[model samples]
Structure formats: C-alpha cells, structure tokens
Target: MTAQAVIQVFILVLILAGGILAVWLRDLLAAVIALAGASLLVSLEFYILQAPDVAIAEAGIGAALTTAIYVIALRRTRRKEKE
Candidate 1:
C-alpha cells in the first residue's frame, strides 16, 4: 500500500479508538475530550483527502464548536440528590 493510504488507515484506527473511549469512559468531561479528538482526526483525514473546505468546517464546527457546547452543557448539569 502507498504511504498516503497507510497514513489514512492509521488515522482511521485512531478515530475508532477515540470513539470507543468516548463511549466507554465514565467521566462526562473525558468522554467529550475523546469525542473532540476523534473530530479533529476526522478533519485531518479530510484535509489529507484534498478537501480543505470540509476539513476546515469539521475542525471549526465538529471539533471546536461542538466540544465547547458539550463542555458548557456538562458543566451546567447537576447530579440528582438522594432523598
């Protein structure tokens, strides 16, 4: 396989790992961080695929904006108190 192909595969594997970690983590903040990492990797993959516009959108919206929103939401949530 070509170098580019190998790199793409590696990135894909990392993305999958991040996704799994996001799902498996008990901490909400950690899960958000893992998801953000996967989003960034996806943006990088788009850039490597020659889609710069999509990559930029994914980085800005998927990685940055979405992560910020999730973090803010998580911060505002309160745990239920035992009666």
Candidate 2:
C-alpha cells in the first residue's frame, strides 16, 4: 500500500484505541480526555483526506469545544464513576 494510506490506517487505529480507552476508563475526566484525543485524531485524518474545512470544524467543535463543555460539566459534578 501507499505511504499515505498506511498513515491513514495508523491514524484510524489510534482513533479506535482512544475510543476504546475512553469507554474502558472508569474515571470520567480520563474518559473525556481520551474522547478529545480521538476527536483530534479524527480531525487529523480529515485533513489528510483533503478536507481542511471539515478538519478544522472537527478540531474546534469535537476536540476543543466539546471537551471544554465536558470538562466544565465534569467539574460541576464528580470525576469518578459511582458504584
């Protein structure tokens, strides 16, 4: 395969790993961080795919804005899952 395709596949693997980590973590803040990381990776993937506008939007909204909102909400609440 091409180098670009290989990079895309690597990014996809990282994105999936981040998603899995986010879901597997018991701490809410950690989960949010993982989600943001996944979002950033997705934005990078979009950029590599030749969609700069969409990449910017994803980075801004998905990685930054949403993460900020989640952090604010997490701050207002608790950081760990209650059992």
Candidate 3:
C-alpha cells in the first residue's frame, strides 16, 4: 500500500479506538474528550483525502463546537445526591 493509504488506515484505527473509548468510559467528561479526539481524527482523514473544506468544517463544528457544547452541558447538570 502507498504511504498515504497507510496513514489513512492509521488514522481510521485511531478514530475507532477513540470512539470505543468514548463509549466505554464511565466519566461523562472523559467520554466527551474521547469523542472530540475522534472528531479531530476524522477531520484529519478528510484533509488527507483532499477534502479541505470538509476537514475544516469537521474540526470547527465536530471537534471544537460540539465538544464545547457537550462540556458546557455536562457542567451545568447537577449530580444526584444520596439520601
């Protein structure tokens, strides 16, 4: 396989791992971070595939904006207290 193809495969593997970690993590904040990492990796894959516009949009919206929103929402929620 070509170097570019190899790089794409590597990125895909990392993205998969991040997604799994996001699902497996018990902490909500950690899961959000893992999801953001996957989003960034997807953006990188898009850039490697010669889709710079899509990559930029993914990075801005998926990685940055979405993560920020999730984090803010998580922070605003109150945890249940044991009676």
Candidate 4:
C-alpha cells in the first residue's frame, strides 16, 4: 500500500476510536481527552485538505477551548459529587 493510504487509514482509525471512546467511556475526563485527540486529527485533516483557516479554528476552538470547558465542568461537578 502507498504511504498516503497508510496515513489515511491511521487517521481514520484514530477518528473512529476517539468517537467510540467519547461515547462509551464512563469517565467524563477521559471522554474529553479522547475528543480533543479527535479534534486534533480533524484539524490535521483540514490542513491536508488545504483549509488553513478551518484547521486553525478547529485546533483552537475544538481542541483547546472545548477541552478546557469540559475539564472545568467535570471538575466542578466532581467536587459537588464529593460534597
């Protein structure tokens, strides 16, 4: 197989695994981490598709902001659960 095909398969696996983990994982934090990985992979795919603006937005908003928000929310709720 060609290198490009191999890379494509790898990316596809990452994306699918991330999706599955995000859905099936019981821990909120782990789901967020998996989703962040998916976001980064999507951003890379966008870059490969020659959409720099979309890639940047996905990296910043999808990977960074979403992850930060989810983590913070999880911490907050977990603290409440402990109380």
Candidate 5:
C-alpha cells in the first residue's frame, strides 16, 4: 500500500475513535475536543486523498470554526453551571 493509503487508514481510525469518544464522553468540554479531533482527522484524510480544496475547507471551516463555536458554547455552559 502507498504511504497516503497508510495515512488515510490511520487517520480513519483516529476519526472513528474520536467520534466514539465524543459520544461516550460525559464532559461537554471533552466531547467538544473529541469532535474537533475527528474534524482534524477528516482534514488529514482529505490531504492524503489529494483533495486540496476539501482539505482546506475541512481544516479551515470544519475544524477551526466548529471548534471555536464549541469552545464558546462550552464556556457558556461553564458559566451557567457555576451560577
């Protein structure tokens, strides 16, 4: 198998594991982090698959923006939980 294929497989496992962890996790912040990790793995897979456009979109929009949104949401939850 090619190097890219190996990377793709490895990243696929990461994505799957992250997804399962996100679902099974009890902590909201940890779930958010796991989801972000899955998104990053998706971005890596896109890069290995040689789709630069998809890679860029996944890295920029899916990973970064989504992670930022989740972080904000987590912060809000923390504030609410504290109150």
Candidate 6:
C-alpha cells in the first residue's frame, strides 16, 4: 500500500485505541482525555483526507471546546469510578 494509506491506517488504529481506553478507564478524567485524543486524531485524519474545514471544526469543537467543557464539569465532580 501507499505511505498515505499506511499513515491513515495508523491513525485509525490510534483512534480506535483511544475510544477503547475512553470506555475502559476507571478514571473519568482519564477517559475524557482519551476521548479528546481520539478527537484530535480524527481532526488530523480529516486534514490528511483533504478536508481542512472539517478538520478545523473538529479540532476546535471536539478536541478543544468539548474537552474544556468536560474538564470544567469534571472539576465540579468526582474523578473515580463508583464500581
């Protein structure tokens, strides 16, 4: 396969791993961080796919704003899992 394809595949793998970690982690903050990582990776993938607008939106909203909101909410709550 081509180098670009390989890179895309690698990014996809990272995104999948991040999603799994976000679900599996017991710590809420850690989970959020993982989700943000996934979002950032998705934005990067979008950019690589020639969709700069979507990439910027995803990076700004999904990675930055969403993470900020989550962190702010997290600050007012517990960080550990209950189970």
Best candidate (score: lDDT): 6
Candidate 1 structure quality by residue, lDDT tens digits, 1-83: 99999999999999999999998877788889999999999999999999999999999999999999988888788422223
Q: Candidate 3 lDDT, tens digit per residue, 1-83?
A: 99988999999999999999998877778889999999999999999989999999999999999999998888888423223
Q: Candidate 4's residue-wise lDDT over 7-75, tens digit each?
A: 878888999999998887877788889999999999988887789999999999999999999888887
**For every candidate, C-alpha RMSD to the true structure in Å:** 3.2, 0.7, 3.0, 3.2, 3.3, 0.6
TM-score of each: 0.91, 0.96, 0.90, 0.85, 0.83, 0.97
How close to the true structure is residue 12 of candidate 3, measured as C-alpha lDDT? Answer: 100
lDDT of 5 by residue, 1-83 (tens): 98877877888998999999988877778888899889988988888778989999999988889889888877766622232
Off by over 4 Å in 5: 78-83
Model 4 bad stretches (over 4 Å): 79-83
Candidate 6 colliding pairs: none
**Clash statistics: count for each candidate:** 0, 0, 0, 0, 0, 0
The lDDT of model 6 is: 0.98
lDDT of 6 by residue, 1-83 (tens): 99999999999999999999999999999999999999999999999999999999999999999999999999999999799
| Model 3 TM-score on a 0 to 1 scale | 0.90
Clashing pairs in 5: none
Candidate 4 lDDT (Cα, whole model)? 0.87
Score each candidate by Cα lDDT: 0.92, 0.97, 0.91, 0.87, 0.83, 0.98
Model 3 C-alpha lDDT versus the unseen true structure: 0.91
- Model 2 worst lDDT window (10 residues): 74-83
